[model samples]
Target chain A: MAAAEAAFELPPPTAEEEQWRYGPINDFEIESYEPSVASPGPIQVPTEGPSGAAALEAASAVVTVADGWVVNIEVSADAAALGLTIQAGLNEPRTGFGEDADRFDRLHEAFAPPTLCISMRDGAELETPVVIRSHHTGQGRACFPHAVVETGEDAGLDVVEYQTSTSGKGFAAPVVQLSAGAASRLRYVVVQELGEGIVQLGRILCNVGSQATATAAMAAFGGSYARVRTDTRLVGRGATGNLIAIYYADQNQVHDFRTYQHHDAPDTQSDLMFKGAADDNAGSIYTGLIHIHPDGRGSNAHQTNRNIKLSDAAWAWSVPNLEIENNEVRCSHASTVSPIDLDQQFYLHSRGVPPAVADRLIVSGFFGEVVDRFPGVGIQDEIRRLVAEKLDRRGANQ
Target chain B: MTELVITDLSVSVGGNEILRGVSLTVRSGEVHALMGPNGSGKSTLSHVLLGKPGYEVTGGSVSLDGVDVLTMPTWERAKAGLFLGMQYPTEVPGVSLLDMLGASFAASGIDASGLSDRLSEEAERIGFGQKFLSRPLNVDLSGGEMKRNETLQLGVLKPKIAILDELDSGLDVDALRLVSRRVEAATEEDGLGVLVITHYNRLLTELHPDRVHVLADGRIVAEGGAEMAEKLEETGYAEYASAKPAATAESRFASGGFDA
Candidate 1:
């Protein structure tokens, strides 16, 4: 009970905070929501291969969130061999919970019966990526998931998170924090494909230590209203970060994204590129900022956002901001929003390329810039196939 | 016989008349020269024949072997063996010249296999290098290169009727000779009907058209055999321009007769 009381204390939000400036806290109109009881459900662990159910068996940890509750938890022997610990349900069983439990804490207290926590020992490297899957299946319910990843000095880790749904009208609020120790490297990727009636708010925070590097790739394809926020802070000199995102929206859906690149120490570098395409009355909004502190000298940052509007009614808004307070810094940002050229269309059409086929080719070429930047050739091929499938579906529907 | 017959054609832009009662005929296996001063509606007539937007065909008919050409869409006209070698072709960035030619052939119902070989052979006939095949269509190309590129399209497309709009505008002597040779080859090999629109007799000297018509004040002021071109070269267009008043006459001097 004392532990629950200690962890449930709410922190006041400051008006001067930049992150909460446009937040919709007043819409919720709640001082706090009481934490619900944590009820564990049936755990279904598939024994198939990674291509099927068997791949989950090789994951360092697997956590499932169903019907606004964490129903299953699995940690593989490989993770145990690395001396990792799993933490979940930090507050209490029931009575000790209070109204001060915020949305994330409420989810942590109510639904998260077991939270998958992974830590790497010094000089240890995990060969397989840790998989965390959150499945929502309920009407008018919301789920909150929190993940904390930490790596010891000189350790390496890879994590892949998948957020999806079986069927339902619900919201998923997922928060992730990654801390990389000195000389450690981490590669993280998140794939979000929720239902059309679902609203998702995903936030990821990363802290990089000296000589460490981090790479994060995000792919968003489904949701009624989806917003992904990534905040990366380079806390040590000579640390590097790379962030890449690609999104496709169709129908009456809307996708919003906010990214921040913070350089807190000298000799830090970051590069970010986001590409998006909207069709069939869909819209997208992207806002990115690169911040360099006064003492953060010798920093390099570049950010680019490119969008394509397939239909006349579809629209996209991009805003890139750069705040540099130190000398010897290199920073640049560029954005473009325009319709496809009619001359290009006519040229392609003149060659007997049908209108739809021409449009698909142009869209594919439009998003190819980001896809080509992917590190692995296999990943690039897979992304290309996924993009082609989405384009085919959109073309067929039209 | 494949022929393009333009009779008493009048076209207007922004409600202002540019071509008034112009008449001419281009027969198969023969070349006809349309010589006129600047702003005399030579290029305007070509554009109107291609059915470009905003150019109103207020009067007259343009027909290809008895089919109405002005009523058809631009691409349909192009597919129906009517080609316009634009004086100033619009540059389309990111589109390769080879690809555009291949697509044009496919759109015109021509098979696409061996298309690159065909384009290359035609390009070689005109002394164009193979490196030119990879460049974007008309983007960053010189005026002479643009003309040759258009002629290359002419060779590959092999249109029955080609309207060469001022093909000799900015070419040097070497380029002019090259273009004239290609036109001569097209006429003999394909039995193609050609309408070479120009302002000078230099291109006509090498082209040697079957008939020459002097266009002035939006109408044909005089028509004669190839010697009419020589007369214009010797006398310039001063006499022809002065003799025409404000009269809107659609006159045709057939063989050796003049009604007026």
Candidate 2:
């Protein structure tokens, strides 16, 4: 988008729409926000992968983007030996993933930069993951960046995209398009820790091939009102799609998540688990669905959403829906929104564990089940430390 | 003055009087067996001492050598050397046994440098494998194992006074033998005061308690040596109810006893 193209665009979504319910849809105005003015820097080639603050040591490659512009890309010799390629362009939609579904996609199409593409050869099993960092800077400037990822048959890949804002007031919209080849395995993690004065809107379009596996995990703990929409499709028989997330909203912050799992082939499987905590006067909204078509006979799908309200004024809304056209498919969904358990409190206090410490333990422990199921990308300790800090701050305020 | 004293302790839970004018005391290193039937206020007395929520101490005074237990929070009272071994411990899903014990020690202001070694020694004394400490607290354990775990925590904490609520209910003969040996050693070596609450005479026989009291109608109805426990075992608490009238209302709801 170096040459700004002038064109007609669709209107942004409003809270009155069912798809944007429980979020700050009325506050999103694309017309008022200015474009990013980030200046490009000299690229630095390296023998080793990225290493610094908040950078993973085990990454095979690193890509850095600031204010919607690509700054640098580094790939190690090991990654090069494994036939990995990284490029930049716009990616056409894969099979069964539509492009004209939502207003956010329209916004991404109108303004998002040329997407970065990362691909791996068949049977390549690199142990270290590929790391991507997206940073936002300046006030009143919006950043829109996108990525496209694909893997060959029997290949394996792990990628993590972490988003943070240095010190600014702005809007960020990011999109990720991923497709796993037959019998391939992939895991993707996204973390958001932006500063106070940012509104983030993100989307993911994922597809799993025959006998392949794809897992995506997200952690959100920042921004004034952060919203994410994810869509997963099991397009081939015996394919699996797993979606999980852990998030927190403190003070008056709001976090919204929407997910859709589509089972289009016979004998496919999909599962979703999302957990979060809301503190102070914060709010969280979660709505998900598992859709099984006629050809998805003998498929299995499940979804669960659990939220904890850390304060009396905090609130959460959870709704899980299912649409199945095949009777042979097995599907289930469950959701719960509650305060901390009183029996749990008494049990800890009677053993001389203080109430504040006990709350922190319980909140972290609430996400342990999910963390255990999806192993390998190490962020468990970081999750615990962040949750502890949030609980400590809440306790100090009271 | 050297005793852990409970003077005219009257307590209620959800506005229902559970303990009325209950008074008791035990000197250091003494093993006292408090015998009462189900719902006879034995558990309520334990909960009030440990400051469990919903147990309102309307009129009572619990003190340890002039330190007012009723006025302090639960953790402070624990740091003041009061420990309660619950009958049914709740399951904390992701908090491991090692983490829980470490937090408890930290809260009680105990020296934690040698905790790992002490944990192993305590597990050995209680006949529980040290591997139990790595698992989540009280999750997926046998009934006897849970009981042994509670006794193990009691040994690890090493409080000056311990109140065991039905410690022998779920334990078999072998486990009971192990716990009794640990408790006896605690009382003899550490000058620990023991208050064992149970309805059965088998545990009292094992510990050979120094004093036995029968609680009925929200008050102690009879007190004697170990023979009183055997007699009550044979004839039950009904035989001692007629010896004294129930506690009076004025003493039950007396205001100034709370020391607030």
Candidate 3:
């Protein structure tokens, strides 16, 4: 627990950093946010699994964080039998954990309660996944949480974390870190569906070692102001990383996402794709960067962001940047932000699908591409169901 | 008799006339072949009949079985038993052909939940595979597939009138033969009225038209028996283009002739 306290005292981020740009630092004033001690509050985790939870659970280690404490953590028995360990604190000063680690350090430092540390034993191939649920209840209360996962030599692990709120103006700040060992494979999924009045900040950092593979899936569907930042660093040769993100914002909500792909090793590859849809005065922003160091030879990276604006008032912005100091590198980025195709709508309507139903179908289909990529069927279904519910609620409110 | 009546229709887009003073009658159990050159208003007339947006009826009346259709919306026109096989049908991503056909069948008042199965049977009869049912609606479909899918929709909906626009534009001999067979079946089995707009006489050879009309410069310059189709095909619409003056009114009638 002392190591956890040290993880919180790291230095703060300055405003001039490139990563901190477009972030709402004013809204995250730690001074204004009242700090409350960790409590063993009544845990209300969804037993039946929210539509997509089953699939998510099958792909990763599962943990449930209610209010401000860990309510449930289900490590797969196979993983446990293979010598997986759950540790609370491994407080070490590293480049990503120290002061000025990144913009995500703020969330990590501010929300230090209910922290989790998971370590995979060497050469263990756990087939079943681990799932974690972070839930918030009551009005005006906020929850801060952190989860860290480390895989040893030739180890494989899958982790799923779900963040949800039960009524009231709930808020959450979650930070996730993944460390991959040589020849290790890891898959992670982070899902966010908080209350409308809630605000959320989610951060994910990954370090890929030699011959390691990593994949991350993110779905953000709720919160008034939800921001997510994902950073992946390839530290050794023959490392590969894939990052995918999907979000749906409606009714005056705002969604922001920042992603970084850092290649420091030779023969490394990274791919990123993010898609979003906005409707009814909602807004979305996606900013991503791919950086290749001088020693990162034969590195390849690609990034794409696509957005659909369902209404005239809805808006989306996408910015992709690449900085390559290495000549033997391949990197490309593409983005598109546009309204729904009228011809598509007409074609659907001509077939007797009411305009609204057709719109929903199209939107769902658009998001399905990303959701289906999730490693778990339960998580896919949960995201689908949540999207459907959101669409229904939006329709009713309209 | 069930019929579609077009009375002195003048249709315009952006204040410029495209279908000017055109009148025709298509009765059930008969196939009318409308032959014309490019930009001769055949597609425009079809769009006007279907009540597509952006095409205003400056003057005209269109009726289906004595029910006025000119004032109806596009979907209402479709519900009134009028089907326009678009020249360039739009692609709807992620919407399967079977689902679309089922919805259309239901909207047209057909009672059945297994419409997809029924459609598959019909499609198989036309030499299309059951796998086509799962394909996205017209997305990445070949021209022949698109034409056959249109026929499938018609078979399912069984509308009183169908206006097939350039149905033979991009088809091989086998596809053309299949399409002609489908049209013949619709007219013979259901006593459905059909208006086939084309520039060739090959399709008319397979499915003989009861009547032929030559459209030139936004008006029908000549009308005759099915032989007229062959004549126009041979002459390439040159005779019709030369026979009519460019700016003539063609006819003048208070409410019924080929004049608005």
Candidate 4:
């Protein structure tokens, strides 16, 4: 453990930086939190625990991590026969984060516990998903959960990482690194539904190989001030990367997303879609960039960000940028921030739908398109339920 | 029997009067055709009746079954049995027809015990396949298909009165015939009163009207039996065009209407 003075000595990312412009950085005092210890066993939670969602029953394996430490792991008989190796307490030093790495990244690298690793052999295929439930608890505590998922050549796998926190003034920083081998298919999802008193800064890094397809999906609906930055690199020829995220922020919460889609090789492809809504006095910010390097000939990349504001006090910011150096590549980026459409409300109302119900339907439908594109199954219903719950709370507050 | 009454209705949009002293009534089991040339407040009247915002009811009274309608909200007007078949059905992405039907049913206090089956039956009658019910409401639907969807809603909602504004504008002859026959069926089976707003008489011959009224310069200029539709069709609304208020032309264009 580091000295208390040393923990406060490290600098935090400031609001002036491009990636942290819309973030509430000035209010985050690093001295207010200290590292939390790992539990010896699975932490006992109440019926309304921080992680209320049942372990995806269809999962081939279920793993639980608490306070940045792996607490439990269960592998199904079918998965064990198929030789799916999921082990904890594997320490891998973090490296190669590039120039964008900031103080938070270093802090996470220094403080996070042993990495939980899930590995698959060449040409191996898992029919069901492996779920990881990462929970954060304790007041004024900081926890960093690190995970690394890898698949061999021509292998197929699905992994889900669920992040949650008990209600308290805590800090969480989680990192996940995914490496998809050549000719492999890797699907990964991370859902963040933290408590209202927590502040979370997370990152998802993906590296796609030749002829491989990698998809990353996320649904964020919690946290007082939550921020996630995702970077996907298509480093091999003919590789494909798809990114999708849907976020809803209620109360005074703030949800921030920064995404980068990098096409570094020829014949690569990437498509990204992020849709979010802000209700009550909540706010959302999305900034995305699609970059095609000089050698990325024949590559195609598209980035789109859409947001809806459900109240006069709610706000949203969307910025999409493109950097294309290859003349032969095709790249496009678009962003939009608007309120629920009036014409749609009028249309519903004329059909005997009340105004409140019409707005609810519109908001629900706005996110429905994104929900349909999600690749996972067991968690899709949870996303819908959370969105509806948020809407119900908004109704009650009104 | 239900009755929808309009008394000396005057309305303005952006401080410019679009409807002036209009009076009309349609009782259950009656069909009334409201004929007018372009920019003659036909669409405006329909919008006002369904309580669409942005239109100021300067001096008017609209009541349904002896209850004041103008004082109620748009959904309340719909719940009070007023339906408007829009000329350009708004495209609402991500909202399915089935979802809309469920919400409407609940708002109108109608039982939705078997909404899916009822919707499937009504959709099939109008050639709107069952698959279409799960698709976004009116998104990418053909013009004829949108009209059919509207007609399907008319059949399902069974409102006491319906104001169909240019229901045949984007329809082909066969689609017009199909939609008209469906409307006639609703009128016959449920005593559904209708105020058909149109620029042409093509729809009149399909569902013959009990009374035909001509609107010129926001006022009802002529009212007669069904033969009046035939006479107006031959004359082509030329006299009515000549009588349009000169001062209203500029305001109409500013309000998004084509030049008369």
Candidate 5:
């Protein structure tokens, strides 16, 4: 599909496209919603908000963006001494994403309030993480929020981004761009908990430099139809990238994920692990690719996607693909979409665990493999709580 | 004292009878060893007692203190003080052994407070590391480690009766000793009833049984005291096999018994 002359004029993505297949694109309408043009006034922390600020007690900086507008920003003294800066708008020109840019990306580029930029100085190793809370609210409104995270050479940085909502129905397209410099260490975590009536199309593009390590973890447990596309490129020698995600959808919800691990340089490595579960009448789709370019000799990449269906009506699709153009590289991909293992259940039952409790434990253990690999302390606990909540909800419904 | 009674319990798989007419009685604080050759119906008896799926109960009644247990589910049977030490414990990834034991205790109406400390103490007594308690249950464990893990649960749960199936299959000399000692300690402490099932008498040497029963072709062909086990150790099950009856449909079906 070609880019529209104007971002607002771009048409909605159709289901015919491979990237949008198995998604709820046909139900989307870009023209029915109005863009968020004016700010929503002074910022006040909403106590009832999902993934609220109270969870992050040791954050070095806290920034809240509501309705695609930056409402508040706070930085600690320690963060300032470490040469960390948070700007409201982009510092440089925003070049359009070339050919692969879709209608949603263009729409975000044209109407997004401002690009929030987080920069870490060289050799700076900040002990505390920076928390960014992106909230979308208002009915029949569309919002685009973008953030760029850049780290200087040999720097160490940690960040947690929370995407949440207040209103019952809305549309949001949030984009985050991450660049890890040479020998730097970067960890970025995103938690999405939008309302059930909301629709979200989010993206995260990360580039890893020579000898740098970048890990990106996302936990999605919200939205009526939430889809996130991630692209991680290893552009320098010996770079490593880890992509992890855990999602749960229940009661007419649909969670979709697409990932790309591109090994473009020699000896680079990337590993992707995605796990999800669907209960009630919900559904989930996971499609990922591990692409090794010709110059990616000696590169090693692996992709794994696993899902569990908790009910006969619940559905899940897992498709993992690998494209290797280098003969010297080693690559593998694995995917599974099945119900819980009976043997595992029997093991629990034989130990005197009741059936209902056994199901919850098995599902929690299913997602535990990915949750334990995540980096943030507060966010990991929140993810566990949210998973348990989902399980409890299922138990109540049944 | 609690007692488990199995009267004329007959089991079949795929329309072929395995245990034609088996009967046994095990009381608390007593240990009975069930010995049989490879083709005999030893493991099948333990599995049927535990209510493992796919084994049909053709005719029989199993009662734990006057409660008919054949109609109960697997977990219900466990909660009713029935335990089966599996030959091959299933690997449950991401679920810690501590969590499993705690949950089991909770389901069985036992207080779960201080479970971690209790597990740690048991680990110390058995020479097992505390780290194993925090690790996933049976995940990535060696065969010997899996057997020892089962023994740990057997000690912790302290069921009224435990049918240990092939408890010595994968243990080294030291591990077998450690595991058997743990079982003996549990019996002494809790007055636990036990039915030890094995193809060899090596395990029985460490954990002595009050009585021994030899099962040949799904029938109790011989029964005696510790002397019987000593005699079998010298002559083996070859004499019993020679005296075994001709191959009936059930015996032929027993040839291809459930191995896993």
Candidate 6:
């Protein structure tokens, strides 16, 4: 409980820093929202709460957290027999996060609450996913939670984490640390669907080991101001890391994303694609870099960021950079920010599709490409439904 | 019983007067051929009718069945039974042809029950396989395939008046014949009024329009029967221009000849 007060005394991240650009550091004032208790009492888990998103329904384990407190944990007996472990918090102090650490990282460290860790043993193969659902209730209450996940050598697993915020003002800050072992495969999805009055800041650090493959997919749709910074480190030879995201921001909301793809070893590969749409007065910002160190010879990395503005007042900014020190490496980054394609509008309009309907179809079709790439996640249809609902809400407000 | 009537229609693009006082009419069940050489405002007329951006209507009146269409939006005009088979179709990335057919058919007030069978029948009628309906709209389609796709939309949409802009240009002989036959068939089956804009007489021969009007310097300079098109093919627009009186009056000319 004393740690929560001490964490607030720490200074916030300054806007001038390179990593702070377009971040919600200025929008977050912890004093405005009530901070969650350091130690919360056991919660009465609601039987019929926010549930059954296909991604969560297909999981073998479900962990539900209420206001930074873990109240429920469920794991299948079959998965338990395979040496899958779900525990609370790290057993030892961690190290090795240097340049990626910042003031936000320090703040989360000082106020870290009940931590949830999901790990799989060596050679374990899971056919179903493990889901973590975090619920933020209470008006103006602040919550800080930490999560850690690890995949053992030669093992494969899928994990999904979704955040849901109830009505009223609040703040949520969550930090996640994840890694894949040698020759392992890990697919992780984090979906942010907060309520309208909340502001969220989340940081994720992922490490891919030798000959391993890792994919981190995120879908962000809620929050008054939402920002995420993701860093992926290819630490071992021949590792592959893929980062993909799809976001839709409507109304007066703002979404920011900063990603780093670091290739530290030889023959590693990384690819990233982030696509989003901003409507009404909503705005989005994306800045990413592909960094290849001297030892990352023969590495290939590509970064692409695309955004579509759905209204006259909506805005989007995309900045993609590359830092390659190895002459043998191949790395490139590209970005595009524009309103819906005029050609697409004309084609639909010529067919007698009204202006609004035409824009809706084109926007849906535009985001469909990104969502279709993740059919394995089984959340594409749900994402589409949310987009339609958001568009309708925007229409009604206009 | 719908009629497309244009009176003293003038348009300008980027402050340049491309179309000056153009007037023509096409009633349902009738086909009118509009011919002109390069820079003669034939395409401009089509765009202005569709109210495409960047083209200002300096002076004009366009009506469909006596309803003023000049103030209507492009989509409303389309729903009001006006269709333009564009000379250059735009490529859209992710929208499939089936999705387009469903939305477009509904816009035209068609009952969309069993839309699959209707889309298949329309694709087949245009010499396109049913699988083509699953493909994205005009993306990576060859020039011939794009033309066929345009005609396919015209057939299913069943517009009262279709302004086919240079359907013969940039098309191979086979594609040109196929597009021509499809438009002709659609006209007969849907009771469509056709306004075919072209510079070549090849399509004019196949179309055999009820009326042929030659546009020059943004105005119709000659008006006559189908043979007028064949005569212009022989003399070309250069000789046709000098043969005319060069007057801006609303003068009517005799068939196969101009009053200079």
In terms of DockQ, the best-performing candidate is: 4
lDDT of 4 by residue, A139-188 (tens): 78888888888889999889987788778888988888999999999999
The TM-score leader among the candidates is 4
lDDT of 5 by residue, A97-126 (tens): 667787788877778777788889999988
Ranking by lDDT: 4, 5, 6, 2, 3, 1
Question: Tens-digit lDDT track for model 5 on B1-260?
Answer: 88999877788999977786677899998889999898688988998998888899988789999999999998999998988898889988889887787888888778999887877777777677676887888888888888888888887777889999889988998888888888887778898899999888898888798989888767666778878888999999877764543323343343333322
RMSD of 6: 3.6
* lDDT of candidate 2 over A1-398, digit per residue (tens): 42233222445678888788888779777667786644345433222211123446778888887777667788899997997877765453322236455555655566666668888899997788888877777478888777887889999998887677755688888788788999999888886777778888888889899999998888888898898899999999999999989889999899999999999999999999999999999999999989998999999999999999998999999999999999998999999999998877777776778887777777777877776765463555555555666777888986
Q: Write the per-residue lDDT of candidate 4 for residues B51-71, one digit (tens) a residue.
A: 888999988688999999999
* TM per prediction: 0.67, 0.91, 0.88, 0.94, 0.93, 0.92
**Model 5 off-target regions past 4 Å?**
A1-11, A45-49, A52-55, B14-16, B216-221, B230-260
Listing every candidate in turn, what is its Cα RMSD in Å to the true structure after a full C-alpha superposition?
Answer: 7.9, 4.0, 4.1, 3.5, 3.4, 3.6
lDDT of each: 0.73, 0.80, 0.77, 0.85, 0.85, 0.81
User: Clash number for every model?
Assistant: 6, 0, 25, 0, 0, 2
- By DockQ: ranked, best first: 4, 5, 6, 2, 3, 1
Q: Write the per-residue lDDT of candidate 3 for residues A135-178, one digit (tens) a residue.
A: 77745665667777888989988777777776567566677889
Candidate 6 clashes between residue pairs 3 or more apart in a chain or in different chains: A34-A140, A34-A142
What does DockQ give for each predicted structure?
0.17, 0.58, 0.38, 0.75, 0.67, 0.59
Judge candidate 6 at residue A204 and give its lDDT. Answer: 80
Error of 4 at B97 (Å): 1.9
Candidate 1 per-residue C-alpha lDDT over B240-259 given as tens digits, one digit per residue, 9 for 90 to 100: 66455222344333222211
lDDT of 6 at B251: 28
Residue A381 of candidate 5: its Cα lDDT?
83
Please provide, for model 6 over A1-398, each residue's C-alpha lDDT reduced to its tens digit, 9 standing for 90 to 100: 55455555667676677777765567566667766765455554333333436666667898888777677789999999997898875562334347556555655666667578889999998998888888778577878777788999999888877788777788887777788999999888877888888888887889999999988888888999888889899999999999989999998899989999999999999999899999888999899989999999999999999999988999898989989899998887889999888767877887788877777777777777778765363566666677777778867776
Give the C-alpha miss distance for residue A221 in model 1, angstroms: 2.6
Predictions in order: chain A TM-score = 0.81, 0.92, 0.88, 0.95, 0.96, 0.93
In the range A5-65, model 1's lDDT, one tens digit per residue, is 5444544433244543333323332223333234436544222221124435456777665
